[model samples]
Target: MARIVVIGSGMGAMASAARLAVAGHRVAVYERAATYGGALGRFERDGFVFDTGPGLLHLPAVYRDLFVKTGKEPLERCVALTPVDPASRHLFDDGTDVSLPNASRAQVVSALDAALGVGAGERWGDFLNRARDAWDRTRRPLLEEPLRPDWQVLGRDPYPSVRRRRVLRRDQWAATVGEIGAWELADPRLAALLESYALAYGLDPRSAPAAAAVLPYMEQTFGSWYVRGGMRELARALYERCLARKVEFAFGAEVVAVTEKDGRAAGVELSDGTVVEADSVVFGADPRALAGMTSGRQAWAPGDVEPGPVPPGRFTVFLALRGGRPDGTVHRTVVHSPDAGAEASAAFRGEHSGRPTITVLRPDDPVTRPDDAHEAVTLTATVAAHGPVDWTDEALVARYADGMAAAALPAVPDLRERLLWREVRTPADTAAATGAAGGAVPPPALAGAEGRHLHTANTTRLPGLLLAGGWAHPGGGLAHAGMSGALVAGLVVEGDGFRGSQ
Candidate 1:
């Protein structure tokens, strides 16, 4: 059995460890933080619990597969899945509002028709159908595979000149958001709706790929699901599975470097200068950070690679409030500003705009608030990466806090008084804590096939290494990250000659 070492305690890392352990490999995971669930991790403040990142859970089946593959059932350990009504409440700039219900396609159509127009329902149905087609054609080929060497292709070599070109076709769609905006939706509102999906990945819709259109379909068809207690429960369950399988976990142990011997990965060096030899090392954090940890510093030359534009980071505000829930609040709400596109552009260009698009999430259902109980609200808004107010000043943090209060809370007035406790997370925090480059969530935003060419799979780049985090391919979502871990385990098992066909 090969000794596999995985970095980071993120969902993907734990999942990959569990899969490998179940396959009879010796696995050890090193997490820099003193906890499991990197971005999926949670914290308690002022008697209220808040998930620091990734609040929503979707595509549960992807997670279920991980448990089944590991000889366990997700439902047996994790909280029961609950369907959210009005999947999302969209607050438009013109004072119009729409609620996407969790129901049948016909019901969704009826809801849209009632809100938009008589024929709008039909148009919505058509859009969903087209999106489903795209999803079916792409899901298995791209998301379900270990996107690596040209040999992993399912069929004949189509574009032999290009490497790893089996994922998508370059000429199929335009790579820029402006180009994709023109092709998919005619109405400006529709284009904005399309952009919302890209925004989920910390990307602007205008430059985000057209294939991202599949996001709405997944939400509309499968619906946005939630774990009963909280999303963190999902991470906890995966962590338990790793323990049950005897996967060794080294929490609070930060990896200082990936030691290489003769052009191959030898093992990892810990922060305390201890080296752990391994047959393979999998990085569950950002690849950019992984590049910094390599032994051959010159092997990773910045000039050797053509870097893509970094997506904007977030300015998130978490509030613990002591008051009755608002009358019209839902699980998730998107408040659009008059100039969302312009504001997003400014943010991408490292400039903060006075008004930015805002997304608010409530920990408790609006209809279920108790008489004297408090609610947890998470407000996320785009901010310029230019350090927020006088970039070099030490007081920039205070300025960011003031910015959140002045800009976000006014829109939802109860936010100020009901706010029992408040904490803010900036892009800087994400980078320092999680090693995410520019604090970006690397979801697959490649436009068409050519754009999807790069393999972000954490471990694919190195023969003896594995990648098990949101930064890898199939990027940035709890379920997708977990699936990536299982995929890596599958590769490891296959590589080790464990062929148990189902």
Candidate 2:
């Protein structure tokens, strides 16, 4: 059996390790932090618990498949997976509020029409239909399959554009999400709804390709889910599954360098001055970290190019409220910013917009609070990465957090009165914990933009080294990272010639 060494205990690393272990390989994982689940973190204080990472999971099938393939028990039997109905409630700037039905296009259309206007629902439905086409065209090549040698085909946008007559001008093809919203949706509220999807992932819809419309489509189609305890629980279950498969883990073991022998990866050197040799290596850390370790070696496979600047990280505020969650409250709510263009510019281009879009998550799960009298409210916003904005400045961080909290007041009435202690997590904290440069949170790989958005391939130029995390192909997001693990395992176990995950 090959002695496989995996770097970092992120979701993708653990997933790959578990699958490889099940495949009869001896897998060992080295994590820089003392815990697993890179970004899926939980913050607890005085019996109140808040998920610091993604509050909800979109496209849970990724994890379900992982559990089914790696163990005897299915995911549901292992973890309490519950569907979040009325998936999300949106509060637009114009006081237009709407709750979208989970995974039901007809219901969503009806609700939008009722809330926004007569034609609003129809326009949204049409946009979704176009997004569905994009999903169908690129889902396989961009997601399910491995990065091909001639990936330029993916550079060509697969989002089908509708032809419209223009006076004294050529018909413009929609390329960016913003263009799609402006050209097709027309309504400011509808445009905001579409752009919110991109912003939530730290993507700049203004520059993000029209394929980004698939973001909302995937969520609306697959539905959103939540774990009972917290998102952290999902990480716990995966870690447990890896242990069950006999994968060994060395926590607090920082991988300092990727050692090589005869021009191939030999193993990894830890910060503690110990070396663990392996037949193959799978990295689940940031690509920048990997580059530093290998002295900038292009572990990229043929036709793979270096990724552009990493996207921004998330800035979060965890609130321990004094009152219990009221009955019949949606799990997620988005408070649209007064100015979306300015918000996007600030986040993506560091334009410094004062009013940023904020997402508030209030889960009624018992595990989050100390008792029935308390509730945990998490407020998050996509911010510029650490360096340019200086997330390390305590005063600046506190001010930003306060601004976000104020923005969420519309959702949580009496927020200041129900006040309990509050905690702020900055991008600096993410960098310190996950080792992501500038605490940049990479967005999931998407098609279009001349393939500039796609991540580096899982298989590297080095014979025995591979990538298996958000930083790799298929890119970030809970589902995408899981798929990265699956793809890495397929290539390692089945052979480099393996096309994709089946």
Candidate 3:
């Protein structure tokens, strides 16, 4: 058995550690913070609780597989996973409202038709079918396996080529997401709905390739889920699973650098001046921090492609409400911007918006509040990653938080009056929590534009060194991050010939 050292206790790292341990390798995880889970953080004050990270889980099968591979108990035995019916309520600027049922294509179609127009549902359903084609074509290469050496083939857009009649000649099928929104969806509301899927994951729909359609297809097909308490419960379950497998964890242990011996990763040097030797190292950190640790040996993984601008980070407002959550309220609501394209432009340009597209989450779980008489709500928006804005400026952050709350007013009537207190979390908080560069959140790995959406490979130039996190292959999001861990373990355990878990 090889001696493996994993950096950080992020879900991806923990997942890999547990798997490697189950494979009979001695594994140790070192986290800079006092706890694990990375972005899957929680906050509480006076019995009001909030999930600071992702509020819902899509593609939960990723974690289900992790639990099955690592322990005797299944994921369901560890945490209560509830399907979020009417998954989300969309509040369009045009006053068109719709609540979509979870993973029911027919229901979603009917709801869209009822809310938008008779033809709208048909158009969206057709789009989803096309999106499914893309998903089926790319799922195995992008999610189930490590980044391949000949990854350029993935760069080819897989959104099935289409032929259309034009006034003068045949029109070429759309390439970028913006093109797809304008050409295929046609209806502005439909375009906005499609774009929202990309925006939520820090992807700029305007520039994101057409393959991004796979995102919505995955969500609407697989279904959205919620844990009993909060998403933090998922993290806790993962941590416990790792412990059950005899994977050691050193919380608050900061790694200073990745030590090398004869051009191979030898071990890691801690901030406390302790050196832990290892046969292999898996780094689950921001690209910037990982590069710093490598000390000029190699900065990027093979087949790594730059996706142009750095991805944005999340800005959140956690509200401690004064009143109870009303019955019959949807679990999540998306209050779309008046001009979503303009909002996307302003966000990518690092300009703040007084009216931004906001997502409001009001889970009915009792553990989040003191009692049924009270409620906890969370409002979030995608904002510029750390460097562009000074999120540390308290006044600036407060104003942004207020703007988010204001934008959410349509979804939550009398929102201001219902709030007893509020807290704001910025990209700076994310950076501090995950060691990500400028709190930048990486979007999940995608195909199109010749693989621009794909992140660096898990296997690096330095032997015995691999990556396991959003910054690595298969990219970000709760599910993809878990896949990153699986890939890293497969590579470490099976060596160079390891393609991926069957």
- lDDT of each prediction vs. the true structure? 0.67, 0.89, 0.89
lDDT tens readout by residue for model 1, 129-174: 7667667766765577665334234222121111222246534534
Q: Give candidate 2's TM-score.
A: 0.98
Instruction: Name model 2 segments beyond 4 Å from true.
Output: 301-303
C-alpha RMSD of candidate 3? 1.4
Per-prediction TM-score:
0.85, 0.98, 0.98
lDDT of 2 by residue, 1-502 (tens): 9999999988888989999999999999999899999999888899989887888999999999999999999999988999999899999888999999999999999999999989999999999999999999999888888888788888988888776567967876888988888889999899999999999987898899988989999999999999999999999999999999999999999899999999889999999889989999999977656767886766664467676796888899999889889999888999999989989888877534598888999987999999999999999899888888888778888788889889998899889999889999888898888888878888988889999898888878888899988988899999999999988889888886788865
User: Candidate 1 or 2, higher TM-score?
Assistant: 2
- For the record, the alpha-carbon RMSD of candidate 1 to the native fold, in angstroms, is 5.7
Local distance difference test, candidate 3: 0.89
| Better TM-score candidate (1, 3) | 3
Candidate 3 per-residue C-alpha lDDT over 67-114 given as tens digits, one digit per residue, 9 for 90 to 100: 999988999999999999989999998888999999999999999999
